[model samples]
Target chain A: MDQQKLFVQIALHSWNTQIARAEKVFNSYSESEFYKQIAPGKNRIIYLYGHLAVYHDLLKETLGLDTGKYSVLSPLFLQNPDNQESEMPPVKELKAIWNEVHCDLKELFNNVAPEDWFKRHNAMTDADFEKDPSRNRLSVVLNRANHVAYHLGQVVLVKPENI
Target chain B: MDQQKLFVQIALHSWNTQIARAEKVFNSYSESEFYKQIAPGKNRIIYLYGHLAVYHDLLKETLGLDTGKYSVLSPLFLQNPDNQESEMPPVKELKAIWNEVHCDLKELFNNVAPEDWFKRHNAMTDADFEKDPSRNRLSVVLNRANHVAYHLGQVVLVKPENI
Candidate 1:
């Protein structure tokens, strides 16, 4: 594969792998465990799940993809920090939207061109972007994947006492 | 910048950002909290820190860079789980090695080229790799970043519970 194409290929694979790992850890949770906090005062498994979905919603906007069906996710889940000043939907509702947003975003990633990826987006300016070209679409994609992995680590602690 | 070069640039930024975030989170923990389980019985904060360094040691070898100073990290941290059959190093000792390993590897990453990143490594075969080009050096780098982010999430729960 061409090197340019290879970047997208590796990135998407890493993104999907991280997501599948999170799904495996998450799906194993009983609905009760989903709501259970990892520690006495830590974010619950459900919050982390919703937290990841919220970031994906941000990714859709940041990457200039079509907006998701669950626009409410941002206000409910974004930057509120867990267990503070917020009420969350039940696990079933959030879970449905989680699946919905991921499916939609994956479709968006499929059509990105190498040249398009290098162009700056999301609040970046031409002069600043020209100085440091790394801050572009590809960075945003990897940033989302990193976000998923970060939360996956947290959710892994929710259960699997031995692991 | 060339598209291939841009891939390296983004990979490096994502890699460094994940590290800086982990460092901030890890540094915030007290000496006591470093040993506290992320949850009831999962890995401790210190274990996750050691785990990341161990993976970077592997990256050094796998990418044909210089070996890290601490081979003991692999036996103590890798796949051992926490509070298990193997004993772990003290937080101060592990902290030293963690910083040492990250500093060394960042230097290694600076020397990598886009073409070198595209070549197959580890167990990949020429034909199999051609069919799945994502299994390359760039993937390994991104894979490590994802790994760090995943654990960063878990360790974030260990203390500063509000964060």
Candidate 2:
């Protein structure tokens, strides 16, 4: 296999693995469980879910793909910390948005040629990219994959004690 | 830059990014803070630190590199859940081990060529690896990088809430 292609595949594999782990945790939690904080005074699992959803939704634009359809989520999930004066969407609506963002991201990511991932996304100016070309689209995926795994660790704290 | 080499560098960049984040979280906490649990009835921050230390130690062997010197920590940190009958190493010693493991790993990893990371490590049997060539050294790094980030999230809950 071409080494570069192989590298991309492996990166994607890790991304998928984290995403699947997050999905498993999300599916396992009851709605009430999502409301519970991972720790005292920390954000709840639902907040983390919404955080990831919005980040991923914005990721499409970061990839220089389509603009995110869920721009409204940014204020609730991204700009502010959880438990702001504003209210978050219902858990049912957040779940749908999560599913839709990932579905769209999967298709959008698939359309990108393996080589094109090396190019800078809209997030970077050409001058800045030239200064540090390491900030490519694939790096975003790598970083965000770890980001997902990071939050998943916190989210798993809501697991029922028995099992 | 060659795309293949660039990919390796970015992968390493992500690995280093997570490591720095983990290190920051580990360094920020006081020794007493390390004793605090991420949540009620879960593992303490110190245990997770030792957990990562032990895993990174074992990773040397998984990479077909040097045997881990910290094998003694395996039973305390890896095999059993927190609060077993056996006692863990002191916080001071665990911190020393964590530093040592990462120091050794950094040197060992630098020695391996970019292309060499694509080769299968000893942890996988030849036939099994042949069936799935993606199980390479680089993949291990990617997986473990996320593993570190995952635990880092849980560990951060031990933070002194003001920040």
Candidate 3:
């Protein structure tokens, strides 16, 4: 494969691996387990799930793939920390949304041509992008993959093996 | 820059970003906090630091950069889980080891040519590498970056902000 294509493949593979790992962690948790904190006073599994979903939904928008569908989650998952007085969306509903958002993203991501990933996304101004082209769509995916891995480590703490 | 160099830059950027984040988290913890669990029964901060150091040390070997100097850490950090009967290295020694390993890796990584990163490393057999070229030196770095991010998240739970 050409260098550009190979780079794209590596980036996508990294992203998918982390996403799959996150899904496996999320799936292992019972609904009751979702209520458990990653640590004594850290974010709960449900909150992390919702936070990831919201960020991914925004990732789609950043890639110019799709406008995010989970805007309602912003206040609860994005703008605030866990254990607020505000009630979270039901676990069942959040789970469904998580699957739906990722499914759509996976398809969209696969279709993007390797060179297209180098283009500036919606989040950045063209002037800034011109100054530093390194802040491209692929960079966002790379960073988000790390973000997922970070939380995956935390949420796994709630599982039986960790304790 | 050529496509190959750009790809190398991106991979190295991802690796370096995670390393810096992990360092920041490690540096933030007081000596006492190193004994705290990420969760109720999860790995402690000190263990995670040693674990990361050992893995990065091994990464040097995998990349054919250097034979690992920190083999002594393997019994405590790599071979056993936290809270074992085995005594841990002091926090000061682990901290120094962590910095030394990463400093050497950073210099070595910078010196490697872009195309060289796509070459197979010592861990893989030639036939297997021919079949699956994706398991190259760069892939190991990418994977290890995520690994660091994972532990970084867990360790950050020890911070006052997260708690």
**DockQ of predictions, in order shown:** 0.77, 0.64, 0.67
TM-score ranking from best candidate downward: 3, 2, 1
Model 3 regions more than 4 Å off? none
Ranking by lDDT: 3, 2, 1
Q: Which prediction has the highest lDDT against the true structure? A: 3
Query: How well is each residue in A1-163 modelled by candidate 2, as lDDT tens digits?
Result: 7766777788889899999999998989888787888888888888899999999999999888898888877877888778834677888999999999999988987888878888997888999999888889888999999999999888888774511
Please, what is the whole-model Cα lDDT of each candidate in the order they appear?
Answer: 0.78, 0.86, 0.87
Best of the two (1, 3) by TM-score: 3
Q: Candidate 1 residues A1-163, lDDT tens each? A: 5667767777778788988888888899988888777667877778888888877866777777665556666665775767744677888988887888888877787877756777787767789888998898878778888888777766766665655
The whole-model C-alpha lDDT of candidate 2 against the native structure comes to 0.86
Question: Which digits, one per residue and each the tens of the lDDT, describe model 1 over residues B1-163?
Answer: 6867778778888889989998998998889888787777677777788888887877887876676566756766786776644577788988888888888888787787767887777756789877887788778888888888878877877665445
> How does chain A of every candidate compare to the true chain A by TM-score?
0.90, 0.93, 0.95
Q: For model 3, name the residue pairs that clash.
A: none
lDDT string, candidate 2, B96-143, tens digits: 998999999999989988788888988889898888888888888999
Fraction of native contacts under 8 Å reproduced by each candidate: 0.91, 0.68, 0.68
lDDT of 2 at A121: 78
Candidate achieving the largest TM-score: 3
